[model samples]
Target: MTHKKLILHVSLATLSGLMIFAPVATIPAQASSVKPSSAMLKKSNSYYKKHYKAIAKKYKFTYSAQTGLNKSGTIYVYEKTKSSYLKKSLSLAMNYWNSKLGRQAIKVGSKKYHTVTFSVSNAKASKSDDSDAWWIPSTKKVQIRNSLYADDLSVITNTTLYNSEKSLVKTANANLAAYKAGLSTTDPDYQSKLDTYQQQQVDYAKAAFDNQESNLKSGLAIKAREFEYANTLAHEFGHVMGLKHSPNKSDLMYWASGTNDIYNYNKVKNSSKGFSLVTSTDVARAKLAVKVHNARN
Candidate 1:
């Protein structure tokens, strides 16, 4: 599969001044045919096989290493219980404007779609934080064919999203932007570099988010206050789908909260802030309006 050359974190200099996270240290590039971790490839391929081909040829596909969408998308949330931490967080994820990023998801156009499914976690046999999520192979195929790869994670789910450090989110977002830029028609070899860059970026982001969260953070639970906690989930979801901050301070996707209450876990904003979890850009990239395949492999 071909893809864009968007190896993960290079230098923040490529992006304008918006980056809030520092650049990761460099690593040598790898050859093609370097398979992704089994978990990442297995899930990503399913997402690609499910959605990428459905995208119309008329629309130019946009993607990089960490994140991208066809013309539209479907974000799938997988969890096992109705009240598990993951489930509660996903509830806010699907709420849109009620969600910081989900609200923005509507704006990115017909490129994406987000779907949530519940799978109960079996305690004793499995730990509560054992679950992870992804876009499925159909989405992966789009990235692979475009030469895209994941640097941080294939998909961000309940604990993974929030448990991550704030700085790591900044890094992934930049890598994602670089990946997206590679797909620009302006790039001379968009397809040629897409796969390697994508793979490296995605792999890099996953490791960074995971390691940083463990290294930099100590302890903190998602604050209660169903509505506010939901918004937080929504905000994090925006990061998951590759959204950046909005200039509008009132916007849920803003870099800082306009209300000075981002910490209010249950705060529900029926005000303009309430909307979907995935941002418009997130949807635009997913190529969601296309058809759906059977369950994930």
Candidate 2:
């Protein structure tokens, strides 16, 4: 089957075939050179350090005073709250685009920052009455609800059941360690156990996906909130990149924001073999946007 059709088919199944796992990229060699601005307030700098430091190093871009939050050339990730998910999600979203669209040079900040500024609001403030997140095209700012800090996916990943799913994630690491100990010389039952663990891992992932969806729909604990928020940021960023929602529900830019498809925020996070990042269609459009943008400027 064609690649696009395959994705649609997999997405339609809900949880039958797992999406292919993309190998996580290694941190850039000189991770220390990219220092974020201390002036930008955040809940913790650790998220920037651990998740975004590498991207900053690789891209080496910052907010442009020239553009002045014009949503042209360079995009700034302003943090409205101290939510770690917000920080990580914005950084990941930017990095995802940077990979596809090519990086832009920045004129401000220390080394290069994601451009964060916390907005304190005591009153209940959200993008709209019906939405959890939205990107304001005119303001050139991405506003996320402050509640994102508390109702996040990490809550699930830190729990016992979540740890079992995590173990499935670590199974490859375990097998690698065993092979390093001496492949053929390793414990004979290890391979059998690894196989069993692998299957159990898939089962756990499927179960986790279902449970997370139910939780999302029923207003229960958010099982994959971090991943969902990251996807949300990516989706909105697609708007910022001058792209519209796709008719294909499997695409990240699907119009309904994953309400009915496998790309549903919860399902994609749980069912994607590993890191549920944006889809190929999203990347392609972003690349086109960047190309047209660069040509005009």
How many clashes would you count in candidate 1? 109
The per-residue C-alpha lDDT of model 2 at residue 109 equals 26
lDDT of 1 by residue, 1-297 (tens): 111111112232131122222012111222222112333323444565655433322122222212322234334443434454444445555555334324333222222443333332222212221111222222331101111111212211222334344445577768867777758766787766776676776688788666534432332222222333344445434433433333333444444322323222123222324323343433443322122221212
Task: Give each prediction's root-mean-square deviation over alpha carbons.
Answer: 22.2, 16.4
| Candidate 2 segments whose C-alpha is farther than 4 A from its true place | 1-72, 102-128, 147-223, 258-274
lDDT of 1 at 61: 24
Whole-structure CA lDDT of model 2: 0.43
Return the clash pairs for model 2, or none.
153-225
Q: Write the per-residue lDDT of candidate 2 for residues 57-119, one digit (tens) a residue.
A: 332322121122333445555565555545655565555556654564222222245432323
Worst 10 residues of 2 by lDDT: 1-10
